[model samples]
Target: MNYNIVMGTDNKTLNPLVQQIYQKIYPNIFKGSKDIVTELFLAVSYDINEPPVIDLSQSVQLKKEDFQSYYTSELSEEELFLDVQEEALILNMLSKATFQACFPNINLKLKLKDTSLLNINIKVSAKVNIQTSIEGKQNYLSATILTADLEIKDAEDYKKYIDELKKYILPLLIHVLNKDLLDKIKLPALTFKDVTVSLPIPVVEKSFVTAYSCIGARQPDTYTSLNWPAETVFAGIDSHAIETMAAIPFPLKKEKEFSWKIISGHVLAQVFNPRAFVIQADGSIEGKIDAELLAQLTLKKGFFKISFGPHGKATIKATFKPVVHNGRLLLTVKDLNIPKLDIDFGIAKWAEYLLKPLSFGLSLALNEIFLPLVSAILRQIEIPIMHFPTISFEIKGITFNIDIIEAKTSKLENQLLISGIPSVR
Candidate 1:
């Protein structure tokens, strides 16, 4: 399991095969409805040192040199001023847009009339305030509020409501936050079953080991085998998600020891050829625990049912650490040793002194029932874990950012190597 991804040089990294992401780059850098009529005439035009409120019987004449001649600045000897490289080229083309593909028929909203006020509506559409009546017909603009709210109050009127929500409520909150963080850039998946870990009975007497009662078994269920083959590289400089992997398997069977207690007497084990290994350095997961136990002794003091010869197998060597309490992610079962066991036939030499104290009480109840039955079946398997497929942008006032960064997986070309960086926060 080795994954590493961190891309963001303007995202667009792809070609792991064929390649495709041209939806005509969204009308070639957004031209939709002529950029919503130049962002509703620069969100209600501005840039004035004075001069605005007009009403000359019906005509059009409200310009601050059409918003300071679409903002121009030089001064090193040329003289101009409203920069940020031309409002960051219309805020990076309305941050890769979405709000219904940038306003065609408008709708934008953002309420909260209480706690510090903050409204902001938009609506529009019906030929957006049509007008042309001198007798020529077609009429509709005379300010009947073609839907346009605003409000904004705290923080010193937030820079005059972000300089009039950078023309059209900051590109409709950067295309509705680039479609809500491009649907959270992918990552999900998990699974598990037949879990019932419970072990204790240690009381080693002369050798000394503690715990003493709690036996249970049944942990055979799996899922979380993954693969994404490849494809999903976008790079204006970086963006990735190719070759994903998470193949996990755990097979432990021995007639799933139904259940048991003490007193009356009855034990039956069969753990054999159990091999596991996943030591990413010290993350732990070592295995090898062959087994086979059978008992039924109650003797002259009370009960009896003797006939235990399967005491013919034992070979330990364990370790399965991976613990993360509180937020669970366990697998404890560290360092357990058995070495060898195959008693000497003929009632297995007095049943190896009554199965050496019931084989050290089933090895301290299989290491205390493998951490809460494999951490409650891996917290009930979830999924997505970087499925990849996203794109969105915007960079100033009405925030929005995400352009891939880190995604790795390549179980021999199963494909997945995504990484980029530059959009933190």
Candidate 2:
């Protein structure tokens, strides 16, 4: 396959994205001043029927420029698309300073030649400044010459002038745009550096575009492979890729209400030990920890507090169901049990009578106190995603955060699919 990573965005998403871009970059849209000339003002109006289109490009070409196809095909291929709220655009300037221009109506379009040659077609309304030379035998009735402006008299001349503009505007605009905006327009929508995936080069289609790349292979690879240029606007990854997740633990915490007297329990400590998140199709993660947790028994006499306590160490085996809440990773301990437990507290033959009852009490603590307390602490525990947020791209010196919608194993694919959309921080 030419590509394994496929992503796309359609028109329904494009319209608002254009408007959103307009709001952000509007203030800085060609914002600069020369003491030679300053105070420039620009106002653009758009019709509901048409809106702007944006792409991931370092250089933008004028609509009327000659077509140069990057990947041409004898048979037509579907175009790539990403509808974003806003994007940076470049424009040329000759002189500014007390200058004002209002484009009454603007319609922008993306046209593709062959497989992926693209040019942005912009149609803007401009009122032409024309001086009239025609004079009627003005007041000829009185032999007095005068000049009068009539509508239809200059109609043909006006058409010719506007038609000539299309030819003149493109070459001039493109030259200036390419020279000034190459490094300034940062498109962060497709940057996935943290995931180690390169943004796919976009291909032009009829009205949409799709970006595809055979970039990086997922570790602990997934099944049900997809054809390049798939319909989903998403990133597919392996669960094993999140190295930090392995540090997360399902531990029994000490709480005054239920666990003040309990021995400590912590799993998957990063300094010495780490674990992997093994995702199952049902949205559960199952793993066994080899580390030990302590369970203690105590026998005390009156106020003197002479005591005997038998402490046990257990290798905790557990399964957890993780969920995201307000951008926090919270684990719900689905199951916690000890398959093996070792306990030995040497006591005199006189205290041997206390061993059986002590054993029974400890067993009761395992089911009644230990399990419930562990589960409760696990429930209250939360790993804030914002603090340890996943990084994606860096543009305009700003990093993008993954707004994950769901993290689940696709039974058919046998891979953990993290579904998300673009979000600005």
Candidate 3:
């Protein structure tokens, strides 16, 4: 299974990345004049009047589909949205139109379709895409722009002015953006040779044009078996405790018509050596165990007598559901079961003692105590997965961090996968 280390980009990130690119090409940001085909010597120059906003007319509210829409410009999917209004355009409409129109402001939006290249300048790109990468030695993401466009939406009369502006402004914007974008997005991913970054159907917010790009990844080879850090589970489980226990014989007692035996021996409380935790492809956890049962017991027909064992060992296998409560990560044990109950002394020494009780009665002691015992050890000791940290990777010496939230486990082929929402930092 492929594990995706998602890297998200937003305005807070985009603005700065684009800024560096724009800065290098500046000093004069669209304060000039142009002669229109109508012999209109329009000398239009303006300064930033109001700062850019996502959209003052409304607050940006998005849905899950907003980030995965098929139609470009679906919602809040563009790479950047900069709606800027200069103080106002001082225009000289030369010739027959030798008059200055009192314009409120020149609304120049550097609105990227996939999008952005923002400034007070009236030039924008058409479509853009930010994607994950497993190819790089260090970085996690690679950003690319397909095309760009700028809409002088309110400046209908300024058509001639815009046409001339695009000649130089647009291409310059695209070049700078392409260079900077590649360098800024650096996210870390599991890049084992066997692992693959899936290029599934590209899903991202709306774009103005058609452009598709996607990325995914798989697990590192070493993940097949993982051991719990604590090294031990429950109490008194060590050495060949199993071999010695299995050797004990169940003592038999004679009775009228029915024979009986009272069993007493050693048993490991936990099902297995909890430290040897192996996560299965199906998400089940099987702990390693060297198991043997020791017993001396009395039993006849449908009834049996039994007590605790000290040398015996059992096996505990379970599935885990990773949960987060109040920001603290936890593995809630689920489907806890005992796969092998090979107790010695012949039968099972059981949890405590089951006198004349049915076999199901034996489940009462071990079943009840086993699950909680293992779970408590993990929580109390602060196991590693319990405090998942912000994942980070570097690119060209720059480091980027992604916080994993709402984390849960999933099946990825034969590997254990823990996927979560990537909250940007």
Candidate 4:
């Protein structure tokens, strides 16, 4: 019996499915990662029986009279018969089928492991066993079989040509097997989306003041005996007042549109007062006089209120300022009023009278006490506060705004530049 076979196998049935699998599997495999096909090839090898034999010295002859009769029209020339070999005919047909199946479009030779023939018409068979895994650790196996019949033309050509086929065919088989395994597994999909964020505006402001107080002074007397015996002796005492005020305006405002949770907040404030007095030999005071008052008299606190509407409208208002009068400086809410809310603090009755004046006065006193000490120490140590005698303030507030503009999905292609400090949670 004469036999010949061509075998082919692909796991994916549909063209679209094959393309999808190719797209998904190609990346992972190309990324230098381990793949099922690579693993399988490393695990097994193809099995072939005894090596095929070819003898070039043998006479090239038609195997049977029927062979000549069958090809009479094709081989009309009698001299051409000498070129024909019985073994070559069978080997060439088998080689062609295997090459076509494995390489598809490429032309290649086949390796024959066995050359013995039992009949004029040769029977050939090809088979492949592949094992691989798609989802889990366990590997699955698949097998294919191909059979065909071919007529031999030359026995010598078959012997020398078949060996060349073995070297190239094995790799092609592995490639086909690998592609099959990849088709069975599912791959992960990657996606990206655009997100919107708001930026916060920072506002900083500053102000300052100066004030004074009174002190008593005494003078010593001198006695002289002499002529008139006036026995002059003089002693006198008097009280006089001096005035000085240091006022600093420190204001801070920050506004942020909220979408996600607030991440971080920080606030800092500093106030400084520097004063000095020079006493002449005549016992007269001439320099800066520093006085202390209630803490509220010099300190001010501010608040921010934000309101959000269902329709996504937002309103933000801030109430804060500083007050300086007659060498006295204070920070009070009296300067702040929300007319729309009908909220008002009379000039004298506001929290300013309670906290602002006291804070201010305390601040002034602190400056009076610390400024001179600091200055004196600095003079001795050669160090300065650098930015002293200035008041600084900071406040942080956060509110959420849920009304986000519906962003178009396809617009995500544009790269987004998010410029802002994200809150720390």
What's model 3's lDDT at 260? 26
Span of 10 residues, lowest total lDDT, candidate 1: 235-244
**Tens-digit per-residue lDDT, 1-425, candidate 1:** 12222211111222110012212122222222212333123222111111112111122222233223223332231333246585454333222110111132222222322323333333221101111111121111111111222333353645554444555554453443234322222211111122112221111111111121111221112111122222232111001111011112232322223223442343444443335443434345455555544544332223644443333455567665544322223344556665444443224565457546655654454333332333333333331222222223332223333333443222222212222322222
Sort order, TM-score high to low: 2, 3, 1, 4
Candidate 4 lDDT over 1-425, as tens digits, reads: 11010011112112223344334344332222121123112222222211212111122222334243334556664543555573466433322222111211222222123422211112122222122222232112222222212223453555443332333333343344335442333211100011111111110101100000012111112211111101111111111111122111111222222221211122111122222323233333223322211111112234522221111111112121222222122222211111111112122434344434443443333334333432332223211100101111111222111111211111011111011111111
The TM-score measured for candidate 4 stands at 0.15
- Where does candidate 3 stray beyond 4 Å? 1-125, 135-139, 153-157, 189-202, 205-321, 324-340, 345-425
Model 2: per-residue lDDT, tens digit, 170-194? 2233322223422333333222332
C-alpha lDDT of all candidate models, in order:
0.29, 0.34, 0.34, 0.23
Candidate 3, 301-360: lDDT as tens digits: 356333333223555554454445433333445555544443332334454344436445
TM-score of each: 0.26, 0.43, 0.38, 0.15
Once superposed on the true structure, which residue ranges of model 4 sit more than 4 Å away at CA? Answer: 1-104, 114-188, 193-425
Q: After the best TM-score superposition of candidate 4, give how far the Cα of residue 125 lies from its true spot, in angstroms.
A: 19
Give residue 176's error in model 2 in angstroms: 6.3
Per-candidate total of colliding backbone pairs:
43, 13, 35, 61
- The local lDDT score (0 to 100) that residue 134 gets in candidate 3 is 44
